[model samples]
Target: MRQDKNDHTNYSEVAQLRQQIESEYRAACEGLHGLAMRARHDFIQARMQRVEEYYQELSSIVGPEAAITTVIKINDAFAGTQRKQEPQP
Candidate 1:
């Protein structure tokens, strides 16, 4: 049916948008971490606000569980990056 096709198209578009938002969320988290490391307090606060906004938007699109999972993944990835940057004793 035409309506079915339209629904599929809409779903595909939404999925694409969700992917874009997830990418942005990951980047934002990394940026926030970098700002903290550099002691940029004002920029860190602004970036933190942006990160929270991204989380809320992600939650609205994919529900709380999926959003939290994404956050966990991002945090784990960031942690790995942090370890790589640390000076070895």
Candidate 2:
């Protein structure tokens, strides 16, 4: 099977980034920006659910231990930078 290019090779890093996002979410809300931030957080979370599903499938082949070792690069995902190219007008 072909390997996915975006797959992460460091699971620990992904865990760290996940922690950071969670901590920020747990902090007291700051108002308007906070509300928008919450929305963005929710969006990322739903995306994470999908990632989790993919991991589950991977675990079947590689075993959970290996699967968790690293998958899904977390840096750009946390930065909210993943996006499809849009045609310029």
Please report, in order, the local distance difference test score of every candidate based on alpha carbons.
0.64, 0.47
Against the hidden reference, what TM-scores do the models get? Answer: 0.59, 0.37
Those runs of model 1 whose alpha carbons end farther than 4 Å from true positions after fitting are 1-37
Q: What tens digits encode model 1's per-residue C-alpha lDDT throughout 36-84?
A: 4464566546655665676676677677897768766765776677678
| Model 2: per-residue Cα lDDT over 1-89, one tens digit each | 12443344334444554454433333312211344545555555655565666566656656788656545334344334313222347
True-structure RMSD, every candidate: 4.1, 12.5
Cα-based lDDT at residue 41, candidate 1: 60
Runs in model 2 lying further than 4 Å from the true structure:
1-39, 72-89
| lDDT, candidate 2, at 25 | 32
